[model samples]
Target: MTKNEWEQDLEQRELEKKAHNRGYRAGVKTEGEASKRVELLENVLLEFVGYDDKCLQTKPGLLKRKRADLVDQIIYQRQLMRELYNHLDDDVRLKLRTKVESHIWPVTHSED
Candidate 1:
């Protein structure tokens, strides 16, 4: 390719790379938020259940509904996490894994 063509190609590649990185960062942020929600829901459920275990012991079917809602949140979080992993680049996934292994537990990785 000509020099101008080469430069144009290089610029395009850079743009693509930037876009991919942005997507990865956004995914990480999404997963982080969902994970936090899951944790919060778990804590709340634990406290509620601590008050009473059985439906009769608890506040009627409210606890059950709450439990089900929490479960749905957990499932949604899992799906979001899976979607993130599926769309993200391998290198970005590795970075996320590294964060996991380091015990840093990133709250967000969004560029903004």
Candidate 2:
């Protein structure tokens, strides 16, 4: 083979080898188990949120629930805004804006 052909073949083999290793690692991690799904989720969350084992142990339920609640609140606010834009009058919109800002601003701006 020419030098260019030989280099191309070598690069193709290296790419295939990397793909195979990734597939093998994924198979090992999964293993067709329900518990493995939960463990994988925890691992991902720990890495994403930078949380340590001690924090998870101390307030696991509270921490998870708070994260979920924040997500739900964001969804609800989006839906409410969409509805208000199409349906609500200025008076109703002003009242809702005032009420939501009063309840939300303090919690969101706290020192903690």
Candidate 3:
């Protein structure tokens, strides 16, 4: 084989190796699973808001519902983080929460 053909083959092999190591094969999440996840997130956020608003209430049903929502949210959030962290560098994953929170609501120091 010519030098150009040999170089192309080496580059192709390297690309394949990287793709295999990264688990980039198709069919990760099905459509139904994605939809269910979205529904769970919405329910969790709604329940959380309700819980925050009714902090004075002691209704058992509401409390149970809120607890269930929170559990689902935590599970889904952890799954998402795991999937994201798999593709991101360790440092970025480690600082993800801090960076997101700081960007959303930066702290303001007042002079006393």
Question: Which pairs clash in the backbone of model 2?
Answer: none
Q: Is candidate 1 or candidate 2 better by lDDT?
A: 1
Segments of candidate 2 deviating more than 4 angstroms:
32-112
TM-score of each: 0.45, 0.31, 0.28
Question: Each prediction's Cα lDDT score?
Answer: 0.70, 0.65, 0.66
lDDT of 3 at 11: 100
lDDT per residue (tens digit) for residues 1-112 in model 2 = 9999999999999999999999998887777544544554554455446686764434554466456554554465565558656698889888777777767886753543
Candidate 3 lDDT by residue in tens digits, 7-111: 999999999998886664433556655765787776555554566655433366446555656577778767665676699877877688567766676763121
Worst 10 residues of 1 by lDDT: 52-61
- The whole-model C-alpha lDDT of candidate 2 against the native structure comes to 0.65
**Clash counts for the predictions, in order:** 0, 0, 0
